[model samples]
Target: MDTSFVKTPQIQQLLDKAAGLQESGGNPRLKAIVRDLTEALMALIVRHDISESEFWLAMKFLGEGAGEIGLIVPGSGLEHFLDLYMDAKDAEAGRSGGTPRTIEGPLYVADAPLVEGNADLSSDPDPDAQVLHMTGTVTGPEGEPVGDAIVHVWHANSKGWYSHFDPTGEQTPFNNRRRIKLAPDGRYAFHSRMPSGYSVPPGGATDQLMQALGRHGSRPAHVHFFIEAPGYRTLTTQINFGDDPFAADDFAFGTREGLLPVPSRQGDSAYIAFDFQLQRAATAAEQGFSARSRAEAG
Candidate 1:
């Protein structure tokens, strides 16, 4: 039962063979990763004395909740770990002075409606929703306006549900989403209904796991953004409302110091004035968005 047993020659041989080290023709990088991961798991098992029943039950939970695996990844902090890892790599590389990147949740759908500069996100008015007007400028780290910048924004509805994932099925295509082509001055603005904070589905996989871990599956009222421009590194980040109750403890790990903006009451509407700064790219690859499989609107 000692953890040292997992490091024995027998376990090492088992891990090597299980990761296809004895075989040929597979990717070398993948084989190495698999071996390392298996070795870590073996150590964890010995350290925790994980029962077979407990392991199988966990696997069963994963198998049964395949659809919510995306939600579970962020809630479990794996996706956030990727973000943090990249942030550390950037810091070590002396890449500094840009908006901090964070986890891009699974709900992003590509190709929302494009607008010249400013466009109302909600096509129809909801009597119960509060109007939110947001305006910002995209500039380089030196405060110079970035040309040809595009600000892609999306958020949940007043009911704390996204357009595609809403159970009510009342939202239209690209609801509360817009891609704004910035002006020559790098200014972009839009107005939409304020989105409410949302929690995972009741009795769902993410909710169940969070509850078992004595945590809540809630995200604060926030706006998701993808800002990209030629010659500047693409910025992936979101701004949470400073006043939201869950802003300090976002379940998705999307909250960062420079990304929280407190809104001001402007008569009957709320207004948020926040600017974005992008770092100049050192290579062509940094000018484009990170390659991740995402949902696309036809």
Candidate 2:
């Protein structure tokens, strides 16, 4: 038993053994990251005087929280931080002429119906929901047209429930979800209902965590997009309604300066015109990747 509060050789030896326990083979980056993470955790535990019981309890909480990691990440600002970091890198490289990226919140599903140039996102409309018509043009970084780009769009309903996550159980399989291909002129349009802002489920872990942290889990009305073309970098972003109360204060920190689309009401319907510019993929790997692949990989 070691009874010294000074420099501990046993601690260093334990860390070394732990780092070497995993067979890294030739992956020095992975090994280094693992070692760094483990050392930081150990240092944190020791510095904070965290007991074994407290550590185990925290582990159990994390295990339970793993199911909702998607929500937890954006709620904890990790997703937005990554987006910001990527934006910084892009800025540093002077590669910044395109639609800004946002969080692809955990609700994305890859199996929406594909349409040609225009789509009716909601086949059957909610009686009280405001009809929405959205049109956009997909362009390259140099403002040239990007024809045949696939754009997947999805949004919540009037009651703030996504079609896949509908609580009422009356929604169609892919209701309010559609994928549209850009026309030869790079134009696309869709018809859907204006979605309402939503809050996290009342008794769920996310809601509980927000309450514990004295935060609310409300999100503003927004439409999600996953755009992919042959030679451009895959774009994952969303368009938030300008009039939403939480537009400026999104709980997920997903809102950006240029992403808000103010609607124009026309005869019991709303219309929004937005455009997306995609950056040319500088690398082959990025050119070959799609939003679906990135979402699944993430």
Candidate 3:
């Protein structure tokens, strides 16, 4: 009948000792966190009459929550955090005027076919699908051309399934994927068929979670790009097809006004062209390395 004994001063002293350990030069922010957690736990014990089993269950849930955070960091919004951090750093260094950087999604594949000029990247035999020719010039912030810049491109097939991830065996080798290098004047071009919209895998873990949350799991029609140069910031972004139904409502929240390309229909071809202006490398150490190399090392 007398549960007040659970809130004894000895327990408070024990919590203070734990707080002191967390404060010992590890991280000041972590020290404050320890204090807050201890106070919150004490309040919960006083308010709800928690059992030992319930306490263990709460701990298990906390561990699972941390794992969920890791998943988000890799496959979701946490990737955007790094982009915003780099943007702030660039702002502090007075680096201004370049194409905005965006996050690379989880489906990028390396070492695609290196094609010259323009080539058909589509695998479908459908004659009704419009052929898309995308041409762009890669330039530095000073308006000078960046020759020999490597542009890696990949997109879903006409049916909205990527090569490696689609289980239906519908994607051929390098279907809707190619890599191209910029010419002397920083120009690059490639052709691919228009891709359809796709939804997240049905009945999979990602879809199961979305269903419980009453959320849709559709992604707009878009192409992925990983552009790199010897002395510029690596750009990992996606270009949305203009007429996609979900273009303005991408579930990933990755679509930006400048990133969307205008799709033109002329006879049997669709054309999209946009100039990419990249920021200059700020330090001598970064002048010789590529973005893929840096990503590999990390």
Find the candidate with the highest lDDT and give its number.
1
Model 3 regions lying over 4 Å from their true place: 1-76, 123-128, 283-298
Candidate 3 lDDT score at position 163: 76
Q: Is candidate 1 or candidate 3 better by TM-score?
A: 1
TM-score of each: 0.96, 0.90, 0.72
* lDDT of candidate 1 over 1-298, digit per residue (tens): 8989988999889988999999987999999999999889888988899999998998999998888887899898998899889889889998888888877788888999989856899865566778999988889999999758988899998889888777988888789988999888988899999888899899998889999999999999999999999999888888899999999998877788888899897666899999889999899999887787788876
Candidate 1 lDDT score at position 201: 91
Candidate 1, poorest ten consecutive residues by summed lDDT? 121-130
TM-score of the candidate numbered 3? 0.72
| Rank by lDDT (best first) | 1, 2, 3
RMSD (Cα, Å) for all candidates, in order, is: 1.4, 3.5, 6.3
Better of 2 and 3 by TM-score: 2
Model 1 spans > 4 angstroms off: none
Say which candidate scores most in TM-score: 1
**Candidate structures ordered by TM-score, highest first:** 1, 2, 3
Error of 1 at 190 (Å): 0.9
